[model samples]
Target: MSRRASGPTEGAVELRGIVKRFPGVLANDDVDFSVARGEVHALLGENGAGKTTLMSILSGAYRPDAGTVSVGGAAMSFKSPKQAIEAGIGMVHQHFRLVQPLSVAENVLLGAPSSFRLAGNATEDRVAELAEAYGIRVNPSAKIWQLSVGEQQRVEILKALFREARVLILDEPTAVLTPQEATHLFSIMRKIASEGRAVIFISHKLDEVMAVADRVTVLRAGRRVATLAIGDSDKSELAKLMVGREVMFRVARGDHEPGAPHLTVDGLAATGDLGLPALRDVTLEVRAGEILGVAGVAGNGQRELTEVIAGLRPATSGTVAIGDRDLSASAPAERIAAGLGYVPEDRLGTGLIPSLGCIDNVMLKRTDEF
Candidate 1:
């Protein structure tokens, strides 16, 4: 592995006048960002505000149209992800990339340098040691598919540590975590930053930013709006900075008696994309005039449950009822014909055709009516 400079600097990682453009859109506009050693820097912005684009430039996924990047106070141009990794930079993307069949230790040592490599037992031992020291726990011998989202995230962290990364960029690290899991991750992130390394946490959740970050930088419309110490800011301040206006936090759920059942599922069983029993004998009911919420950590079979109910996936066993009709064995079209209106998690890809206009896409499920 390539080594960066040996001592502390003003900025562990810094970008100056960074600008990135694609056709008619300027994704990042002369953005300046810096994270110092031993600091937990939170990058905050709404979707399409250039937070990810700026980090992508730093990670070498995309080269900048203009600007300078410096690592450990030395100006550097990174052509690829490998080059950035060589310069003590590591990034864990929102979507994890892991070989499902590979063991945890194998995944950690997969792309690491020979010096960081060890045989089976040694690698497992090292992983255990790192997990203990960092407050992250995972079985080194377990395959990726066997682990939960939190455990997979721990493996990602271990991968960064194994690579000797001095600066770690985590994009929406807690999105898949449960509340308790998110707390655990925050503690682990604190440990990482306390070791005199730089940690850039990218998140849109204001509560988490306030909880974990030492410093917060808000981006709006591809520009840096504010960068302030966490102690100097509050949720409202950060929210205003992100949206360019004052915001209101209010929810009005009027009291009303729920009507008869509209949708019901009993003893629902379904498999995930990995062919695992993601939904196991789950039961739920939604009344005609009520909104029933199903909440859990990501990968806890929410998607599978939805797919099974929407008739996109075959249930291993169970009954789905919309009003008085049982649609357990029905196909998606059949379910739709039975008066079930469903919208998937991915709006652009699954809910609507990106290339089609509003009217055309709206007519997809109602072609006969159109």
Candidate 2:
């Protein structure tokens, strides 16, 4: 397939006829994608639709089995991420790669060639200037561990900008951000594109794509489905193109009567990892045959509440009862034995071991049974 540029400007980054294969899966099957200078091009697809693989190939994390890459209309080959960075292409992945102990400036300039000069506050000054220019609000001297999730994300973007990246690829950038933070990020993306750089935004959010992108490309089952200008498309059409079928915007749910209270918590209090009060006198109850959702901003004690309920963290003060049984002081195993099934947010690391197979992971909590 011929590569279609997102706009009238020359291609800032182009991947033509790209093909990548894993052991038994074709990650990218002759895919073609292009992002023009000063354009915010969004990439949309379902899970395992090869969006990441295609971006990985472009970012030099993986070599294409068959394809061609071009930057600023100049054909080039990159064998490593360093090569890609030198070529003015940078990708900020979903999970950040910053050092927790290092400051924002230190993490941004950690592996830069010019960072070996042993300069004093020059690094922090430069970072502050860059952040100011891009409207990225972050304290350069703040440690990564001390920053919020949104601030850490800004540091990642600062890292790319400090490297002089002309083609910035962001993978699921708003997944961890609040609505307000996501809006701020959209402004930053627009600012970057206005500076004659290209932004390839990879996300599954149709509304955000409609709001921020000039054009969007849909990939289905590892092949390019279609690329349409934002003005020429709507959410419904984009949804159909993404999954190769019509998508329902809403689903009908049957009404059910509430039964006795199954889970109850009163005056819950807990401290965060940094010894700060996370949850303060929170109270809620969930009745049987009903679903309750706890909604809050990213760092607002949701995890702490869950941990306290599951006995993973000590609650400073609270009464947790599961069907009339007080289990706030119970151990994790005892809570599990009391019919509590806790699935942590970090699924792979906490809920299940990645290296272990399904059966082994399933038997983790039932080791004594074996």
Candidate 3:
């Protein structure tokens, strides 16, 4: 087991007794976290475990309702995201924020301080240089829409590094990448930390946390549970800390024969929101009383397949049938009426209305039946 130290200073960024609240929940309660320069620190938690809220406070997206945030040993009170950036803190959110129509270099240079004048092609050349340094290769002149999800992620990391962020926060950076791409990203993170910069990444994947982070701070129910060195901790220990329970990492799969197809999709074709071809001639079937897993690296038509089947997206060419009822041309309502219960991946927006109460959200699906 190997451990690296940040040298001199004990921590580069620190939070003490941080507290934040929403209308109905204590999002963060007297939580404390710290990361050191020249270290890759991982923040781990389950969903709604205050990981995002804590990072938001650190990045100046949300001022802490209470407590203190210090950067490079100096206390900080950030008024906006810009303030955080100026303080050498940069966060790449789980969702990409780049403009689709903008060139890679343009997006990297967006909102840069205009006080410093650059020679023509200097910005592009610098972007290229940073890309090469980080092992991220992308065409600087190409529009964001032309890049793959992995490539887009590279651009996000490059943008942060270009801004000279001393403390870089990446939220679920591998959620959209293949195993190979994730490995590459881990290498880049090591390079960044070795350069005397602080790298804080939010992740739920236990394997990644163990592999990339030198130290980890686990959050549970909006409070800090434990901060331990990677060499001393194992997956079972970390999982227990995150959930406050002994978690079973594996499930027993009982054998059962599959019945007739409950869901059938044939020759599905679709275009992404950018009007680019996403799915092509995909065919699959899920039998009744059996589980079917669609496994792939992210952004490889999995979302399109689900949307087309749920009638949320139009299929350019294909047929979808649920237990003999063809839903290829059906609207979402029609599909719902035909015994399709859709729970979208985005829980706040498409899955349920945030403003509406639970009763009302339930009624939204059965209003016609009522």
TM-score of each: 0.89, 0.83, 0.93
> Which residue pairs show collisions in model 1?
none
Among all windows of 10 consecutive residues in model 3, the one with the lowest summed lDDT is 1-10
Per-residue accuracy of model 2 over 190-230 as CA lDDT, tens digit each: 99988889999999999999999999999988999999898
Residues 1-370, model 3: lDDT tens digits: 2337533245889999999999988999999998988889999999989999999999999988999999988999999998898889989899999999999999998876664335688988999988888878799999998998989989888888888999999999999999988988899999998888999989999999999999999999899999998888999999999999999989998888889998899999999987999999999999988877889987788888889999989999989998999889999888888888777777886788888998999999778778
| Alpha-carbon local distance difference test for all models | 0.88, 0.90, 0.89
Which 10 successive residues of model 2 have the least lDDT summed?
Answer: 1-10
Predicted structure 3: lDDT: 0.89
Q: What is the lDDT of candidate 2?
A: 0.90
Residue-level lDDT tens digits of model 1 in 247-335: 88777889999999988999999889878789899999999789878888877888888999998898999899988899888888778
- Predictions ranked by TM-score, top down? 3, 1, 2
- So what's the TM-score on candidate 2? 0.83
Rank candidates, lDDT, best first.
2, 3, 1
TM-score of 3: 0.93
RMSD of 3: 2.2
